[model samples]
Target chain A: MSSFVERRLSSPVKVAWLVALTWVGCVYALGLVHQPDVAGDASGGFWALVIALWVVATLSVAGLAGLKLRSKPGRLAVDLLTPFLFGAFLFFLWEVIVVGFGVPPALMPPPSAIWERILVSTDLLWADFRQTFLKGVLAGYAIGCLSGFAVAILADRVPFLRRGLLPVGNFVAALPIIGIAPIMVMWFGFDWQSKAAVVVVMTFFPMLVNVVAGLEEASRMERDLMRSYAAGYWETLIKLRLPAALPFVFNALKINSTLALIGAIVAEFFGTPIVGMGFRISAEAARLGLDMVWAVIAMAAVAGSAFYGLVALVERAATFWHPSIRK
Target chain B: MSTTSIPLVGAARPGLLGKLWRGNVGPVLVVVAAIMVVWYVAAVAMNWQGVSERFARMGQDASAGAVFWQTMAEDRPMLPVPHQILVELHKTVLDVAPTSRRSLVYHATETISATLVGFLMGSALGVLLAVGIVHLRTLQKSLMPWVISSQTVPILAIAPIIVVVLGSIGLRGLIPKAIISAYLCFFPVTIGMVKGLEAPDRMQRDLMRTYSASTAEIFWKLRLPASLPYLFASLKVAIAISLVGAIVAELPTGAQAGLGARLLAGSYYGQTIQIWSALVVAAACAALLVVAVGLLEKAVMKAMGGRP
Candidate 1:
């Protein structure tokens, strides 16, 4: 055991491990008494066993972290893994405490309950995925981005509009979506269309602002060259302004991708025909189906993250020239 | 593409209204006036139920006098005429009892409290998290991605969960709403402050290092001061976002005293007049908060040696 410890950990790490082990032993000796409700479960002994393993895991973390700190070349591993370990630790503690104490699902469901629900509710999950991800978010995002891009172009072409519109755009951009979402619901009624309308409003101004800033990129020399070449407005735009604006436009697109999902989801919560991720999450929570609620939330998170990640990848590809994406 | 154009004006001297309305004031007023005029006309002509509907079909146009009369008509559903809304506002703010639910001031105070509490908590936590992340590379990676991603989780979805869970545990009232508000507001502050704190070029950092400045000194004396502009800008945004969060939190859980609950109650009962009045109050609340931020920003900037 000592050799194994030496191979894996530095002196400081070994000391920390020894300390943690001693604490774990003390905790074990102090007792494995459970709550009156949970002390009778078949898995009480199993849980106490898991609790002991948690100690071992905690010690391993301290040992690894210390080893990483003392090394000259391995700090990068520590740097990346520490937060991951912390997050995992948080999840572990949550699971253990919630289960060990036999907390009610209605109040706070265990992670295992959430996982099990996710495994079972494939159909309801699919329906929500279709309503939110496929129809509402995608449609709203496309229309919002395109409209913002077109308006930005017009704003750019007309000097008066650029001066006149950008500040107003800024004001409009600051308008909160909650203020607008219900209004959209009132206007469009309770359907995916209303939800899509909310998404559009949420996304439009941000994209417009980004695209406008982006078009300001070309240098004086570049514009002068274009002028000397006698390029038309569209010619100059297609060749130069639009390309320069790609990074900013992509920035807006990435932002709006998430915004669109959020808008659609939130819109559904206000009033819907009993479908969509937001609706399901709301309805399930109301019913005290905590596991199902988590299942829907997990689905929404995955969908939202995937959408954002895809936009980011596209941005990386398109803006390879941008200083922000260094080699 | 042209780097420079002839300046909008030859010199800095403003021509009266140009000075008062110069930065953003004129444009905001102009837009408000235009919106009001359109709303008044649509109220009469379309007989719209409320502003929301009028806004949906708002692109249609009419003459000024005709629009004016149409707005005054009792039949309008979508557009409440300017005069009518003013009367309603008068009743809510000036005429109604101070403690009445119908009074905008009382409701506004309640909403404001939630907004303030949430914004402070959010801004404070955001700053703390930013400081930690900047000092520790371990935090910057795993947490940064999660922080950004956390935002994508619709507050609507999470609010219900929070309210339900917290309510079950006998925790309700201002704190729950404030927690949600803080969640929304903190993201911008964190992201912005991180950028701001790391704003200095390598040369400037090296200069600081040359003086043998400690991390705390370097942060307090150099980085913190440098990050003020970014911090304030984000604060302005965060405050507005927090108000929205507070209001939304009200919606999911139907608090008795919030602007959100008023809107929800009005909508449920189909009280168009009440709904419009509450909306006006909310919009005014936002406007006031923004104006306050602008004032604070100007003061800070002025104190910071008046634009170099």
Candidate 2:
């Protein structure tokens, strides 16, 4: 047994086995929490066992982190698995504690209950997703990004406007731009359009500021080279400045992706047509349908992550030659 | 690329007016003026139909100029002009007693209190997490991904739920709002601090090792000081979003008291001017918080012997 322990502790793959055993131990502890007597009784043994499992799980995760992986794939696997295991451990703890204590679902619904609610509410969730994410977030993101890009170009052409706009843009970006949601809802009525308008306003300044900074990224020498080549304004912009500006533009895109989702969802809190992630969250919470609220929040998390990931992927493709992407 | 066509104003005039025109202030003022003009036009256009309907209801055959004037003066205009909002702000923020619910200053105070509480707590938590991550390889590997991805999760969608849940548990008033604010602000600080803590290069670490310095000593003397600039940058972001979180938290509570409550109440009653005034106050609060952080950053950086 001592030799087996020593062998497992010495290598990355063997350490992964230790991690797997600890994970099993955590699952077994969760099972113990699910036992009938544990729910009703505040037992000392159950608490002790749970704490012990937690310690073991934590140590194994730390051990996994300390592993010296020699292969690229092994390193990548560990990189991905560490966070995944940590998140799993947290969810497991949440489930165990909630179930063990028989805590009120209203205060904190367990993840299992949230998953069940999500499973049962697909159609409603889909409709809200369509209304908020598709109509509001996408439309607003595209319009806001394109207009910001155009204005940045125009501002580049006119230095006077650039000088004036940069400060204003920075100032506006720092302000609580979401405060305009009520006004947008008032103007555009309580539909996805109002949400879209809110998103547009929320996203525009960030894009403008980033793109403006980006447009100036090309060095003096590069600009001079373009000038010596007798490049026209459009030619220089396309060949020199725009490429240089790609990273900042993508940074703005990533920022705006999250902003657009948030603006749309929050705008729905003002008023909406019986559908939207925000509307559902607020409406359900009022009714104390905590499970459904958690369901909506879970869906939102997935959608937001997917949207941001999509943007990052596109950014990677578009700016592949950039130093950051290359790294 | 040719510069000969335009004469240099500084060389020609060398006056204050010329300096203002050539400097940042002139263009900014012009832009602001232009925005105001556009806003006035938009206000008139948007309010036209409502004004005309009211005129017709009152059996008055008003001229175009009269209708335009009425548009600017409507009580609940579709879009309130700048002066109407300014008047509302003056009435609510200046005229009313600071303690009154009708006072914008009262609501602003509520929001700012929550923002400051949350900002302090969130930044402390962020610095703590950053320190742990920097010291513990396990924490760096495990928590970093989640920290980065947390910002993408639209965590504010759960703000209402948090407020409701905490309120149900008797954690009412400011604490629930502060938690949301802290949640919103902490991510930036953590990300910034992690970067800042790792900023000490291999050479610096080696030199510290050569001195036989303890980890705690190195952290306090080297990492903490080096991380100030990043911490301040993130603090600026955190403070702004902290204000946002406070306002949003106030929203789901349904017009109790706060700038967000003012906004919700105004929206419910079609009080466009009220909403605009509340928005202005909130914006001012955000600007003040961020500027305060920036000034603190400058002072601390200066005290640290950083370049002015």
Candidate 3:
């Protein structure tokens, strides 16, 4: 029996099966025998079992991966399955712990409760999204990106401005620009406009620095070819420099997507009318509405991920010819 | 082609004056001078209403020069001039004792302390996570996507929740603020370290394997050293963000001390000069911290026998 067990462990497929079985057993223990009360009031033994099961499941998954799968599909399957299983397990643990332990709803609401709150407050969430993401973040991102690109072009034309502006750009980048949210609110008043202004300020410097760096990406040989073709500054820039800069420009876009969202939200915290994600979070948290706050967080996470994913997808398409993507 | 036939521009021997004019300092000074001029003009425009209102209340017909001067040097203007902020900084830093609440130095220390604590916690966690992720494919697969997705959720939106939750759990003040700072800081470090750890080419890693080096041996000799440059670059970013985190964390808590509080207090009383001074001090602190990190990187690289 010992030899049989050792032989099975030596095979990656058998090890994967063992991991699955262990996971099933852990889930059974968590769900059936040691299930705590609605208030999560459970004995110490029950909590101990939960912790032990977590450790076992974690180890099993790690063992399954460490043995190393030979087939590409097998590796891909393990990679895909691992995070999904881990994520599900974490959520399960969170739900069980919060529910079974009777943790204060005010301090830590269960995922189910937050989900219900999200369902009930769809309209409110939509309005806040419109206010923060649609109006403030998007508008600011467009303006900031355009101005950064334009200035980068201008700086490329003028060596003096390039030297002068790059340092200034670096200096501004180091400033905790999010701290300017309050001042921006004061300047532009307590509305989405103020938040948008803050987003612009937060995002502008990053884009400028990135585009300036990106503009230098074209190789000397490429520029020489342009020069040989008798290309003017505008022609060389448009045909060679700009294309080479796309990867860096997209990097800035990806970065600024998060920055813009953060700026708008933080700006809302200082002062805002009834609607916006930041305003909602601060307001709900103040009222001890932890569930509502979580709901808003879920919204922000989805929106942010979608925004970032969109930018990345665009980058992939735009930079397909680049060696980094070609592989 | 017209361009192909054009004469090549040769390097010219420049006089001292020409060299000075073409240098970085000259351009930077010109830009700073331009900004100063613009700021002074904007200050006058923004403060004109308050100046005029005060003059009217006094029932005095002021000359244009008096208006200009008063606008530039108001007791509490809507937008304080640069000199006004300078005066406030001098008074706050020099006139009062550092321990005083009213002094900017006290608040700066409080914030900086939190920032440092948070940065240490964050960097330690980041390096550990990177090490784990690099060794364990399971973690790399599971943790990396989540790590990438995590930053999308703005910490500012969640800062209050963290503060209130932790506050209720009987943890308060510095720990909560530091946690927020760590949250902001850890992402950059993790990303950088991951890239850095994986930086060693396949041949280099295979060399370690050929020598039958232990995992720890490989990590210590190859991976860690290779990751230093990326680690330091990210460390600078992390430190700056940590400061921002400490400041933002102060905002939601209604904390009595910190740079964020100074800005808040200034805003409450419409003390524009106070706000501007705090901002300037924060910027200066960020600059100093970045320089400090750069120096540390030099020392670390030198010790590692890498290029400084």
Best by DockQ: 2
Q: What pairs collide in candidate 3?
A: A39-A102, A40-A100, A40-A101, A40-A102
Give a tens-digit lDDT track for model 1, residues B58-141.
764544544455446543245456677778889889998878977888888888888899999999999998987787543565
lDDT string for model 1 (A33-132, tens) is 2445553242656567666766665555545444535465657765555456656656656666676666787988777679988888899899989988
* Residue B292, candidate 1: C-alpha displacement in angstroms: 2.4
Candidate 1 chain A has its poorest 10 consecutive residues by lDDT at: A26-35
In the range B41-78, model 2's lDDT, one tens digit per residue, is: 99999999888888888989867888999899888998
**lDDT-best of 1 and 2:** 2
Off by over 4 Å in 2: A1-10, A40-42, B1-13
Per-model CA lDDT versus the true structure: 0.75, 0.88, 0.85
Q: List-wise, what DockQ does each model earn?
A: 0.34, 0.69, 0.53
In terms of TM-score, which candidate is strongest?
2
lDDT of 2 by residue, A58-120 (tens): 776776677777899988988998899999989998988888888999889888889999998
Candidate 3: where is the Cα deviation over 4 Å? Answer: A1-38, A63-78, B1-20, B53-58
Spell out the clash pairs found in candidate 2: none
Q: B131 in model 3: Cα distance from truth in Å?
A: 0.8
